[model samples]
Target: MKTNNNGKKSFVQRSLDWIEKVGNKLPHPVVIFIILSIITILVSEWVYRAGVSVEFFDAKANETTTINAISLFNSEGLYYIFQSAVSNFTGFAPMGTVLVTMLGVGVAEWSGLIGSALTKLILKVPNSLLTMVIVFAGIISNIASDAGYVVVVPLGAIMFAGARRHPIAGLAAAFAGVSGGFSANLMFGPTDALLSGITNVALNSSGNPYEVSINGNWYFLIVSTFVLTIVGTLITEKVVEPHLGAYHGDFNEHEASELSLKEEKGLKNAGIALLLSLVVAFLLMNPWFGPFQTIDPETGQKTLQPFMNSGLLFMVFLLFAVPGYVFGKTTGKIKDSNDFVESMIEAMRSMAGFIVMAFFASQLIAYFSHSNLGIILASKGADFLQNQNISGIPLILAFIIFSAFINLFIGSASAKWAILAPIFVPMFIAINLSPEMTQMAYRVADSSTNIISPLMNYFAMILVFMQRYDKKSGIGTLISTMLPYSIAFLIFWSVLLIIWYALNIPLGPGAPVQVSMIQPLIGLM
Candidate 1:
């Protein structure tokens, strides 16, 4: 972090510059994953020979489960390593979501649908407020999973480029909100449901016999959405945008030019198609007799709802693809069926780099999982905190930092929580802290570092997005740019939680910071 001759940059600035420089010098992303896979294999063998293992309460099954490290260096492990290669790539969650969603997004971008909309949007939106809006949109997009990373992040760059500002700055703003603000939303979505179900199990395992409701952390998350949006906007407009300076990339450079009659007609037609698509999607998800609708059977209520499953994925495809095709046809960007198909092909071509990276990334992630490294490490880390004998705000801060640190290696929130929850949830309850508060701390920590974690599910996808704006941009460039937002969010989010607790506010409806306040509803059982 050396200062330049003028020394105008602060230490933080110099540090970020150093990080970017050092990070980009590392191996190419694909090669990095390959190296990581090798490292994982060797580490697993070492831990296995050392007889390392972890045993924690398996809250779901109501028993203790032991996890022993299985060496990828072993014969059986090697077989699994070779056997699941193709399936690993295909099973990577973001792979199909990106490819399928892009089928329409590709058409939208190339067909001038997305471009025209962005142009008009840029002209209408005050430049000062653009960052806030993009950040807000990213936070809100969480309610519809996976859409933000693929759709919103790129569009942020396009809009900023069209506004004659730095494109990467806009992309950072969106990425910060989408990934870093992941757990914060105005409405409780599937993440809430999944985490609460685990929380309930953990609570019951602690002998509380309570029902940790899905809305347990609702109040905090709602406030967090606005807090993060503001924090992201500030980081983008003040820090990231200024640091990046100006955009010299090969942007379209379209002015605030009036739309041609053909463009206007295309927009109108596209709007109709979009509206119709939504109408049909609604009908298909209607609870009465919808084909995709299914009762949980256990709860006797709709469980696998459209937004709750892959139904939303297909809906995203139709939403963009139908409108893009109609717009392309109306504007002569698409001449016929072949032209429509070609748009999709062209989109796939742009994704070539991402697709290749996904292959090695998939193997690396799978190997790490198969080795039992993530769960064991998460357990050991939680055990450390539990033995510390600390309490109150200091203990809270330690837990938040621990959760954030663990999140770097283990990207999946649920996976990490499944191990940590059974430990922390009960431990916190023993100290008079509610399970909801513990869950809130975990969620805050989980999200704060996602933008900077290479192991994050969509990190490679975002790298591909970055390269579109800066061909030479590498992992270092991405991390350096995003580091500011991560730091700001971690600080702001944790402070907000602390202040809320100090004010004696409930985390959610009937979910207090004190365990004693929570009624053990399951005593009825």
Candidate 2:
């Protein structure tokens, strides 16, 4: 047993070493972009010829299958890539959505609005609820998209460290709730609204129309908030904390700075200013009394069609901008409008790598979607699962495992979902399984495996950050430390889902607990 344990440790160490060495040696993300594009194109051809066809429920459109390679070489295929690339770079992908939203966030981040706000927010929480506070806040931060990943995740580790506890445990707990908990937010984020929009478009293309509310997954996702928090906190305190010894790093003073009086004043003023702004904006848009009301008197529906779809981005801007400007002027970072604009532009500059990745990711998704790969795979897989007559409990568990496995190769949650959703959403919907449930399962798998995946773009950024504390810490150290959280999160979260299913709890408002009980669907068996 000792020899086997030693062998396993050695293997893990070697694997980490290889990942660090090779991961850094690779060309820029742009090169990976080109490679991924080529691979996506190849996969499209392979999947198409393999007899994959997207089955639409629309009687008029029936099912659609495009010749993957033939379409690509065709003029239309070439035109689509060129057209899409411009949009991809210009914020057509999640990056675009995130970037435009960050203009407001940039102000908040630059003016220390986020830091001060976070401090004020968490400092008030009681010790007993610290873990849940961190976890829940991390989950909710998804409303600002990557702000949860960038700001809240590291702050979780720092916050835990300040609590005189295992910092790694804090990082793990936070990472679990933030990244692992990505899909299960209580509020609809820009991505949620955006993806739902895309899903609607995809369905509409097949002659079946779906409302943008196709994002009804939020009802279920919100409940997952409590589920993940409990699981994350338990895994942190019980499993992860005991594994790491005492804090021995030189920088382990473990003190979190207190907010100053000026910062406090700024926060107070910012809140008041923001509240007033919201009231004014609402009054302006109200057809009953506001200045810019555009409601149709007959239908009572607002004629402003773009507002619902684009509202989240606007919210993001307001959420960030108000606090940012308030903090900036008070903190003396913004004496003029130029400073504010610069902050936004600077934030855009920071996303250079993400933009590059988005370029290829966008193309890959477009090609795959056009080729009908996602639909084909989802239909066939869903069909097979239905044929097996597997119990729902086991099926959910297996689905989690499959997603985790796939996550190793594909790191971007949105990108992976773009490919998977078209197929899984409809397929699951057909099986009487809610798309929300499948989305929840996919998030668990995607998030748990994120830290361990060499392909995760942020893995490199994390390695660099880890090196700041321990020069000896490499890929292996990071992965080894994080792998436990990954395993625990998957196990605990999966069990929670099972219990929820058994109890017949609503996953969300208007979301069903069971896909079907009386009559099993045709392919679902």
Candidate 3:
């Protein structure tokens, strides 16, 4: 028994060392994206010249279609590459969202509103439930998009530090919930709309005339929210915290201080500001009088609508900015408008690396899309699966595993699903499985692997957060530390999904595991 235990320990240590070594040897993420962009351009040319084509069933077109690679090395491709470069960078989804949201969050953090609020809130919680609260908060924070990564994750570390526990454990738990449990939210957010929209496109493409609602997986995800919280708490307390032992780090002395009179006043003012902001937002979104309300062309009904499908981001901005500005004024952190502007500028400065990386990433993604490589690969993969004579639960499990493996390579969940949905949604439908079931499985796989994927957009940000305490922390340290959470989430979540499938639970409103009337197509099988 002792020998076996020693062997396990030795193996773990060696694996960690190797991961660290390999990760450390890699170029900076921005450079890596630039190299990838160049490679993609070359590959597009090569594939186009070689006449690589795939026969895919175009669901939207309701017919078979041949997809050919478009080479980016030609005159037309060169013009596109040059013309679209600036637009690509400017229009990158995360670029604008993060920048705009941070303008508000920056003021809050600079004004000490976030710190004070977090301290008071966390200090009130019993030590035993601290992990649970942090984890749960992180899970729910997905409603505000990437705010959790910026706010809740670091706050978890701070709260844990204040409680005299291993701060990294708190960080891990929060990260697990924020990224690993990203799809598991109690409320539907922008991600729901974004992913479901893509799924709908794929469904339409696959000749399915029905559109999936945004809340297709809401029920399953709500339950998953609690499951992740419970699992995150257990893993943090039992495995990660213990393995981390005690913290004798630079942040040990950074305990929470009692709220001062001015801070108290600031909090009061901030609360009032938040309430007012909410009221204003509510009015703006009201169907009867709201300026943002519009008529849906297809449905021909008046409706309160999101601003460019990004009402959540705008709402977050309002929630943070109003409270932050009030807090800053009340606490004398901002004596004038200059201070507020400075705060926003400082926040933008911090995101310089992300901006640089986004430029290259945008190019890479654009090139890849033009090349038709993603769709080709997805179609081939689906064809291979179809030929295997697999169906039912086993097929679902295999797909979940395949998605997880692919996640390690492709970081963006939406981008990956955009490619995979057209292939799998119809295939699954042909086999009598509901599109919702296929989507649910994909979500499970995507969220579970987020923490360990180096290509994840926020991965570098996570490292920077870790380095605040441990200067030696790097890509390997972050991955190794997070590996346990990833494994636990993947195993437990997959089990939950399988159980859900077996019990034939409704994934959401009108979403079922299998469709009764839809018989399997024997010819396709």
Native-structure RMSD, model 2: 6.8
Q: What is the alpha-carbon lDDT for the whole of candidate 2? A: 0.61
Which one is best on TM-score?
1
lDDT of 2 by residue, 229-329 (tens): 77777766654555444666643444446889888888887888788778867776665765454665745765433443455466657767987898789
* Model 1, span 1-525: residue lDDT tens: 223478687677777788889999998989999999999999999999999998887665656789999999989989999999999999999998899999989888779899888877887899999999999999989888878899999888888888888888889999999999999999998889888988887777766776788899999999999999999998987778767766777666544567899999999999999999888877877787666688776688985544555768777988999999999999999998888888899999999999999999999989999899988898888888888979988988999999999999998888788788888877777677888889999999999999999889899999998998898899899999999999899999999999988887888899888766343322210
Candidate 2 wrong stretches, greater than 4 Å: 1-28, 46-83, 118-131, 142-175, 183-223, 234-255, 281-308, 399-487, 503-525
Q: What is each predicted model's overall lDDT from 0 to 1?
A: 0.87, 0.61, 0.79
Position 501, candidate 2: lDDT: 70
User: Model 3 reaches what TM-score against the true structure?
Assistant: 0.86
**Candidate 1 vs 2: which has more lDDT:** 1
TM for every model, in the order presented, reads 0.95, 0.67, 0.86
List of clashing residue pairs for candidate 2: 91-96, 219-508, 220-507, 220-508, 432-515
Model 3 weakest 10-residue run by lDDT: 516-525
